[model samples]
Target: MILSTTPTLEGKPIQQYMGIVTAETIIGANVIKDIFAGLRDFFGGRSGTYERVLQEAKDYAMQELMEKARLAGANAVVGVDLDFETIGANGSMLMVIASGTAVRI
Candidate 1:
């Protein structure tokens, strides 16, 4: 299935609007990883642990969004939007949400 951040896909006319689809993912820092990430922050380089977590969360959210779109019988997802938020105690957790309009082209 095709997914686009724009409202429409070029050269692909929308045949039907299948309503909206959305998915969210939340991940928290583990104890050991948190300690290492803290050290990386102090040392002034990118935190690989955090990056991995973000990537995993994003992938999971996207997967879920696609599944929802498929269940909606959509050929594509348009006007895709992504949101990121920090939650949990001391903002120790990460949340990612994906939303879009499921459509048939």
Candidate 2:
């Protein structure tokens, strides 16, 4: 499936609007990793663990959104939006959301 933040695809015209499709994922942070991240924060460097976790969450959410579009018989999604939220103490929880208009080309 093709997913984009733009309103229209490059070559094909959107044939049908299959309503809105959205997918979200909530993840709990690893305490062990958090401890290391705290230390890394003091050193003022990148946190590989945090990056990997967020990336995984985004991928999972996007995949789920794509699956929803597929179920709706859409070949693509347009005006895609990505959102992130951090919840709980020590940023222990993360939420990733993907939203778009499902369409058939």
Candidate 3:
């Protein structure tokens, strides 16, 4: 399914609005990853471990978002919004949420 951040898809007219679809995912930080990330932070460099985990979380959230749209009988999702948040003490978990209007275009 086509997912776009814009309200309208280029050259594609929306035929119907199937209501809003939303999904969220929360991934906990792994101990090994946190250890490596802490070392990287102390050394003042990027943390690949954290970055990879966040990326995976985002992908999973988007996948869920698309599944919601499909279940709503939408061929596409428009005006998509993605949000990120850190949860738990010391930001031990990452939350990714996706929302959009499910549509047939």
Reference-based TM-score of each model: 0.97, 0.96, 0.96
- Ranking of all predicted structures according to lDDT, beginning with the best and ending with the worst: 3, 1, 2
Please write out the lDDT profile of model 2 over residues 2-101, one tens digit for every residue. 9999999998998899989999999888889888899999999999999999999999999999999999999999999999999888668999999999
TM-score of 2: 0.96
Instruction: Candidate 2: list runs displaced more than 4 Å.
Output: none
lDDT of 1 by residue, 1-105 (tens): 999999999999999999999999999988998899999989899999899999999999999999999999998999999999999998889999999999999
- Candidate 3: lDDT of 32? 93
Candidates in order have lDDT scores of 0.95, 0.95, 0.95
> Candidate 3 lDDT, tens digit per residue, 5-103?
999999999999999999999999978999999899999989988999999999999999999999999999999999999999888999999999999
Q: Write down the RMSD of all candidates, one decimal each.
A: 0.7, 0.9, 0.8
Candidate 3's TM-score reads: 0.96
Considering only N, C-alpha and C atoms within 3 Å, which residue pairs clash in candidate 2? none
Q: Is candidate 1 or candidate 2 better by TM-score?
A: 1
Candidate 3 residue pairs in clash (backbone atoms < 3 Å): none
